[model samples]
Target: MKCFVAVLIIVTLATDAVSEASVRTCEPIKVAMCKNIGYNQTGMPNLARHTLQADADVTLQTFSPLVQYGCSSQLDLFLCTVYVPMCTDKVALPIGPCRGLCESVYERCYPVLSEFGFQWPAELDCSLFPAENNHEHMCMEGPGERTAPVGTVTLDSVNAGGRSACRRLIKPNSWVWVRGSSRCAQFCEAEVLWESGERRAAEVWLATWAALSFACTLAAVGAQLACGDRGSAGERALVLVALCRCAAAAGWGVRAAAGRTAAGCAKDSTTPTRMLLAHDGLANPNCAVVFLLLYYFGLAASVWWVVVAGAWRASVLRPSVTTSGTGTRNDRHSSLLQLAAWGVPAALAAAVLVTRDVDADELTGTCFVGNQSSKSLLALVIVPEAICLLLGTVFLATGLRAILRRPVPVPAPTALLTSPPQQITDQTLLRLGAFAALYAVPSTCILATWVYEYAWREDWLAAPVPTEIPSTQPRPAFWVFLFRIFASQILGVMVAVWIATPRLKALWRKIAGPRKPPLTKCPAGPPPTPLTLHCYATHSHSLSRSQMHKYATYRPPQQHSYRKPRHYHYSAGETIL
Candidate 1:
């Protein structure tokens, strides 16, 4: 009976050895286990391991079957995924020196899958080599029944191996058979291998956005340098330049987006399995960076143009009070003309900027309004913007305050009175009045927006975006509108127009017109001929009658005189006689 038991033990060990030998040619997946796989299997075997890849495309994979076992904690959950290409795949590739096929293609994992009654025999297929072998050679095998108990499996670690050999082997009809026990393994491995070309495409997209961004920066800076001043014609030219730049930038953006989408479609067309996971990390960065920067710069420029308009208005209204003939204050009308020209463009630019964000959906790229990192960032942009617009309005108001108060010039009664005052020119008054009236509307609107945003409530920024958009706090509505406005340079053209208008020239012409002669009575005929008169008093001295007569007739006046009234001589130094 003892011999029978020993024989049964030997036979069991021999069967186990043969089973191990069956899978010797196929290398085990090398995975670092968190929990021992054989601790508590319900008569099932644990086959957790790691696989390594050779190409630059495939990354890493892990597998953990513990999820099915109701293991809740990280320790209880084993992480397992697939590694592409077997050990045989590496040996077939062009390997580097120092590191052979295995080392070059993949990393070796330790603590082999020996816990589940598995033995990695040092010498595998020893009998397969038939050098000097007999027909029946003696051999021994281990027990078929394993004594090791199954335990809960846990995921311990994951390491990135360079790439997958399977990726290099992937072709038209290549099929990867996944072991069903590990769920995440197949998908993870497949993505890593298939994403190489897609990643390169994404890099190209990013490069294009960056190029467009830099180009736009140059164009903007150039435009500012070229037409920095106000006036309708100059502003118009500048606006046209700005519009060109914006259109170019927008064009680049559109192309980039199309390229990205096309690349995704192409990938999908070729690889039916890659349809759901089309969007990758590579394409996102370029799209976001280029689009946002362009949008912000463009918006900033727009806001600047509006401010410029306000500035122009303020400037026009500055010389409102001038010295009238009577030392009184007088208004200039040219200010109003200047204001109207500048303010209209500014207001229109603002309106455009405020409304542009509504069309942002078609342009997947992040623009000024849609791409705030946090609520605080959005607030930071909006509050300052609202304040700027507010300040501009204030400037306009202060400038225009005296416009309505200008006194009607009192017309004089005489010909001189009827003529316009020489002191205060009609051109000057017209400019002042024009500036005050025209700027009043837009500047007031700016002030209103500012009040609504920064003052009406704490939620001043709420006007820009809809209430339904999720937010931790209110965001100013100006941002969304400003983006589209900024993107277009119509304001710049308007500025040019303001600087070079027919009215502006006309005002100057009216100012430079010939001056009318000052009021004066015609010079009464030429002054009286130079005549000498003498008045002689018939006094006591016995002077020549001729002298007395000379005194009475034509007196030559003495240069010096004293009021010695007792005796008076009108002309001669000698008294009466």
Candidate 2:
């Protein structure tokens, strides 16, 4: 108990630290572009008209209206003709002027128009516009001329030429016109603030933590199973539950991966490799994986509990009983029959689950990891189980208490001379009753709770959104979500460890283990065994001397046996029969 408490405290402290670290170290996304939209056609001249129309639709639906419809066409044309040329004015440019310039205008300005769908574009080129580079706004450099050290004229002078020129070009009632130019800062500085090491670390941490959690969960479950001596029924039920959980978890992982893949593809359609790479680089899959792992371990604990219950009954309670077709009942092999009943159903269920797939969508990256099948199965199996467990526990406790409290009776000397008939004792009866109740009640309660939780509502037992570290949330009102985890998993594991430890096991054996059989009453050793004999004398079945002779014909008769006996006459007063 002390060890468990200490470990829990350490884990809690670590988790708290992690949560605090997340708050401090993790950075929020800047709400940058996530998607963009544009015409699919290529080499379409005068794209400004279509672009303006698209922008108009996007603007009306999203941000406040910046320009009226009558001026929309003119604004588009002016942007295409003026902003397009000015931005691409580098000497000896690789992509060329008009440089698919309409594409650049669309890419730079789409984020502002499309807030929800504006995503980052793949290529840095102008051609990768509306669909990709959906930055909120375009950065337009001020007109400039610079004089080099050799007195060669250049556009580097911000105050004298570039700044004044840009200020003079501003149009009335325009949302995009530049107000001024700063010599010390480049126009590109605003968007460059996005790239950060902290963001990358956070993503990596989430993914790694999720993976680790899942692995640990699986390990814990497997460890529990390995630690116990479980019979076939328990083994079967556990396998069924585990397989279902695994399948569902796989489905969810696949779904998460699919979403990531699709997002990546939409961002960089030209490069399939990048999309695939991104698919492999996400966090939610880890969380789903860990959850599945926990399910596996939880299943193990439940199976062990069932095993213990069954074993306790077989060892301490139910007396062997047997029945024949006739009035007399047989008392042997009853335990064997009971064991068979539990084993058969469990074996079948395990076999079926092992052979069959839970669902068909895991491979498509759309369904496997977070699928609902396992949780559904849990709901199916837990209710009856919980009820059975609780009832059995109550029955056992009651019987034990009754036996200890009952008074003993004294036997008379005459009665003590004869042994009592072989009949079941009150203690034996109580053990059977206790076993039945304990085995049934708790399992049923648990099963019911699981069903209610699963079937009640979609988000009734919602897990926190995926994160890099384990998080602590305040207690939820739902008993299924909170108490079960704390009791059945955390507390259960601790209890099992405490009970199963070598020292505890030794102590228990000393207290309640089997003892040597009592000595027999015969002072001398047991006498030679005697063969049982049966004799019958009836009116029609008495054996005569002649009959004895006939039956013994093969053997010679003795002289006394062969001779007929002569009897002496008795006096009338003294009668001889």
Candidate 3:
């Protein structure tokens, strides 16, 4: 019996000695970079199983670039705590950072590292760690809770609401939201992956079209000025369309040249990340200016298209009996068109600014309204474009109907070659129709894209596809944006093409032609007079004087008398030249 008791005691002592031998000791840190890790001593072998501090310090050097990249504010701390864990003799094992900490740092910095062709280390699997610091299973919360005793709090739900709101505003397509950090950024903004070329292509495409559009519109406007065609109110309204297109297209280039850094992409922390939540207004100067240039001037371009079709001429054309009323009515109509064009766009842009709805497009890389929130897209872009298109279409149909139904004038044999008083042409009507259709098609396509964006925005966010995926197959939406980009440039090119009448081309040729060589000697006579017809009539004829200038039948006079070759009548007080 004594021998049995002795055997049992020996077994107990052996088990205790084995456990005591296995106990890990806290060792002083030798790593220079990890010195600030809350505690000086760490348990060995660490999460990486580096037995000595020197070994741990060496392995950690591999992650130096990620730490320096500054993706997460807590990256350095997380890395240090992971390699050289906090150790105390009071506990049997060392404690490492929580899974939450690892995940937060991993998500923020992974994309940055991936850009360099690095993969996340297998040893640092976040799923293997504890979720939070607690008595039952202790782990670090983060820097904020580094000094706190274990078993205290969890940061899981702290940022949930803010992150959710940001997700909605971003409406990420070829990008992802990293809300773990204080700032939520699009994944591609921080790191361009294998699909970097696609993003770059978008920027270049927009910039290319913008340059083309700008030149086209400028040529149209300059042609009007150079040809001396600005006198007609219809031509004046057409010029306004060209001017607005120029301004709007110029804004498109800003985003292309600057790429993702341009306006509508403000990342200031002082600003709210969510559009719907930001009633305080967008404080970004660039964002506001670009918004005004693109939306305000773009809408104005559409508005002026309506005026070009029906308003200007309808109000100004008179029966010649009441010519005095034309000026007052035309001026009033002009004011109303200006108000609808400039004032309405200004009001709408102001509303967008106040709501802070601006965001960058992934396909175009240009900052524009309604790209972020589908609600904003519906309210600001779709509605406005639809209304303008409708108004322009209605005006165009009525103008065409009136022109087609007009009574044909019976002409005197002498007046066979003379044009009727009305100046509306088949060519003019076609241009107006072209302009409206151009606006309508693009606007309709854009509305379709937004519809797709709206329908899929949430589903996409719920299960995000890897935005930087490398494959030839792309989403169907990509082609939709491509069409949109291509179509937008079409308007400017067509406008310039349509307005380049034969007369305009002749004027351009005259201006571009070599200048007449200076006269070798001073002319002894005044330059030949233009408007040989107008030289005799110092003033425009009044409508009441139409009968006075009508052609009369000619008769041969007596042999002694001289007969005028042309039977032209003169006003009562006019000089016969």
Q: Estimate each model's TM-score.
A: 0.32, 0.27, 0.53
Estimate candidate 2's alpha-carbon lDDT, on a 0 to 1 scale: 0.34
Error of 3 at 315 (Å): 7.3
What TM-score would you give candidate 3 relative to the actual structure? Answer: 0.53
lDDT per residue (tens digit) for residues 1-577 in model 3:
9999999999998786466448678888879888876778887888887888988888888776455334566777888888988888777666888998899878766765675467989878899789888888887778532222322211111232333323333232323233423223353243222246676676677788889999988887777777775444565777787788888888887655554554535443322332211111254556556667888888888778777766533632323424356556666677777887789888988887775566555444455676545567778887887777777677666655665677776767776454453344434545555665565676667657767766765444343334777534223356666667777676776677666564477696786996777879767887744432321323454323443354233444557733223323434344433
How do all the candidates rank in terms of TM-score, highest first? 3, 1, 2
The alpha-carbon deviation from the true structure for residue 297 of candidate 1, after best TM-score superposition, in angstroms, is 3.6
**lDDT tens readout by residue for model 1, 368-414:** 33221122223434454455456555655665565556566676567
Top-lDDT candidate index: 3
Query: Candidate 3: where is the Cα deviation over 4 Å?
Result: 1-185, 188-194, 262-285, 312-327, 407-414, 420-439, 464-476, 506-577
- Those runs of model 2 whose alpha carbons end farther than 4 Å from true positions after fitting are 1-113, 117-289, 317-452, 455-480, 497-577
Top-down lDDT ranking: 3, 1, 2
lDDT of 2 by residue, 105-141 (tens): 3433454345324443333244423322123333322
Candidate 3 local distance difference test against the native:
0.62
Q: Candidate 2: lDDT of 426?
A: 38
Q: Please give the range of 10 consecutive residues that has the lowest summed lDDT in model 3.
A: 271-280
